[model samples]
Target: MMTTYLERASHALALVCRVVAGIALVALLAVTIADVSTRYLYRLTEGAIALRVTGSVELVSYLMLCSLLAAMAANVEKSQVVVEAFSHGLAPAIKNRLHGVYLLGFAALGLVLFLGLVDSAQSAAGHGEVTQDLRLPMSPIYYAAAALSLLLGVRSLIEALLGALFGRDAEVSHGE
Candidate 1:
């Protein structure tokens, strides 16, 4: 029952994050288009209109970063690349445990990322750091990334524990 609940709750969270990631990607596309079009328009006008999207590069980088970070937790499980050749012959119960171990590994990775992002954000905050082009504060971006990393770690950990404790809802398939 506990595993079931965890699975459902985590699934919902992943769905929401997936939407956020999608929106970020769309925004990235729009920004790129605007930047390029403005550049082209300026050239077409022979410098008549001094129009350019400033900080576009920085904005792209930030959007890409946020999109990827938002996606990590949502896609971690199904995106794992594992060789299933040996596990093909293993019993169902053993396979489940192996999957649990894999999930735990993901949790550990997320924890590492969370620690690093948080540390960097703190350092940036202390130093009053900002992006080179946009002059936007860096700490908030780092904090948001750190929060997402934390979600990845916690959700992965919960799924790991769920897979280990109960095998009914925990299914693992690699390259299938």
Candidate 2:
């Protein structure tokens, strides 16, 4: 199939999101390991070793959010929990149309999330709010989340448009 420019762009963005998500997961794992190890050692030493990862909770929370948000752009269509038993009787074209409508709703949801993140980022910037425990600026994190949300919206919108225009009935594969 001849892919459109929008599809190409979305694919590239998915690649980027995948890389970032992987990084976030790795970072999260490292932080968790370090925190657990230090806490264990501190307990064993009976206050002799007063060393523990400060704000590990904050770090994990941020990384977890980033990883999940980063993954949405790539997996929105591919990772849906499809229940075909109810729609099994529908014609293929109708199924395709219904799926397109579902995708449209998902796109709208992503757009709304994007807007909310941007607004929160603006408010955080104005108030100079930082995260609890770790004093990391919240605005930047919100902006990053906003970008991911926008990417998800665009990817979903493009997929919906393509599916509707091409009438993808036979090409629906719920596989990565």
Candidate whose TM-score is highest: 1
TM-score of each: 0.89, 0.87
Candidate 2: misplaced stretches above 4 Å? 91-93, 169-175
lDDT of each: 0.80, 0.80
- Model 2 clash pairs are none
63-145: candidate 2 lDDT, tens digit per residue: 99889988987776664455789787877666666666677887998899999999999999999999989899999999999
Question: What TM value does model 2 have?
Answer: 0.87
lDDT of 2 at 34: 98
Q: Tens digit of lDDT per residue, candidate 1, span 1-176? A: 67657877777778777987999899999999999999999999999987888999999898898898789877766654557787778777776666777889889988999999999999999999999988888999999888888888887887777666665334432121
Native-vs-model 2 lDDT? 0.80
Clashing pairs in 1: none
